[model samples]
Target: MSELPAGLVEFLESAGWGGAAIDPIPGDASFRRYFRVRHGARQAMLMHAPPPHEDPAPFLLVAQWLTNNGMRAPEIYAQNPREGWVLTEDFGNDRMRDWLDDNPDAEVSAYAGAIDALVALHRLDPGPFSPYDLAAYQREAALLTEWYCPAVGLSVDEEGYRAAWDEVLSPMLARQQPGVTVLRDYHAENIMLLGDPREGAPQGLIDFQDALVGHAAYDLVSLLQDARRDVAPELERAMLDRYIAACAPGPEFEADYARLGAQRNAKIVGIFTRLYKRDGKPRYLELIPRVWALMERDLAHPALAPVARWFDANIPDELRASGGGTIA
Candidate 1:
């Protein structure tokens, strides 16, 4: 029998879900928990984001902001920010990722549909969030050296790492403000394949509490260059073209896409290594090779020249090729 959290029963009663049955659901890469709540014929997903680590307030606010603006963010039925909990509408089991697995032939169309959601999302005036600024980018990019380097027992040039990111990212400093609500984890796994494709918001977006007013290219990179899955190169290009046709964010889209892709990949590598070495989760280590592949591809872009040079000098090809394989 799964034990309910303290006050959860009362909380459910107060939220009109009194005596609801709660079943645990697997959480994501964060300090949060989830449960499926059932009351009669109704089912809703409970987001248990305990504070001092995870905050449900931002998730609630951002979710409503999205729904109010005609997006398909989950509907929050009730919340206790103090407990970092919220009962939200269940989006069902069809993640765009699993949907793709069953419908391999539908990959292109599924991605195209996902891109449509992105297009619709970016068109909206962004909600309140901190800027994904130069300092933030530099801080994140340095994580590669901060965690991954030490994990692999290689002492890298941390200063060069920051310098490279600075050079590549500094040019776009003016492109900072008025960015769209970047669903920071806007990948297939986080997207729910809701009903009819022709209906209102065919996609149900989730895991967006970390959203920020950042480069429009950021989420596009996230979707195309996924860390958890492989997106074909040709399809990646096609989707880029499709998004360009729809939103036309700017002429600098391609460069920014590559630049941010590299930066985000670096962050993921560090975080994954940290998950293993510091948090005792080794499964994430397996994803590092794929992330490195994507990072290298992004680094090939002209806009990533400075960072590329740094990687060339500091990180040996054999080390990256090992894919954290040698790391304990």
Candidate 2:
């Protein structure tokens, strides 16, 4: 039995499941922890977000918003925001990756469902979320130099990197048409496959606490260009086509998607490196190469020309991936 936090124990007791068996679920990069609780015939998942490090308000608000929007987010059974704990419906251990692994033939349908969910989400208004505007995008893109460059013993002109990114991203962000809510981490791991294919919300969304207002294609980039898993190129193109046809976003959508994809992957590269150097999680280092590849692919788009030039000048092909901090 893993040690439960003091507040979590109290919250579970107040929720009438004090003595329930707690099975710790594997966590991601965030500070939030999940546990599957079973008492009698009832089962529920407890989300414990330690205060000062994390909060449950955004998760609760976004979950409610997604549910209200007719998409399937977890149902909050009970919540103690002050204590940073919430009990939500456990949609089982069937992750979208599970379905994709178990039934390879259903990849097309599964991705289609995800894209359709995004289309539905994009149509709704971004209630009170922060916009992923120019400053926000540039700040996130800076992570590459902030963490990754120094970790690999490579020198980066931080000012140059920022200037190049600004040149490309400023106009893109300024021209962004609002309305879509960009779920910051809309990848396979956070998406759960639930219910029948023909039914409502075949995809159950989680880890959307950081949802923000941004381009409709932002989440699409997050989904198709996942850092942890491989989404085949064919599926990527098909889903992009599906979204374009359904939304009719305009001719600039593809360019924006590619640009965001580059920006997002660059952020991930730094984040993964930071996870190892700062957070003491070395496993994320292995994914650095894959993320670099995705970044390269996205930079092929003309919209990312300036950003690509910065990378070519600073981070060479050999220095792209981490050397376990041994390259001096």
Tell me, by lDDT, which candidate is best: 1
Candidate 2 overall lDDT versus native: 0.85
Per-model TM-score versus the true fold: 0.96, 0.95
Best by TM-score: 1
Query: How well is each residue in 247-286 modelled by candidate 2, as lDDT tens digits?
Result: 8998788998888999999899889888888888888988
Mind giving the per-residue lDDT tens digits that candidate 1 earns over 1-328?
3476676777788899998888988777788888889999999998778878888888888998999999998988999999877999999988988877887877877788889888888888888888888888988888888898887788888888888788899888677567788888889899898863434338899999888888888998889999999999999999999999998667777888888999999999999988888888888878888998899888889999888888788888888676644666
- Worst ten-residue run, lDDT, model 2? 319-328
Clashes of each: 0, 0
- What C-alpha lDDT, on a 0 to 100 scale, does residue 179 get in candidate 2? 53
- Model 2 regions more than 4 Å off: 196-201, 321-328
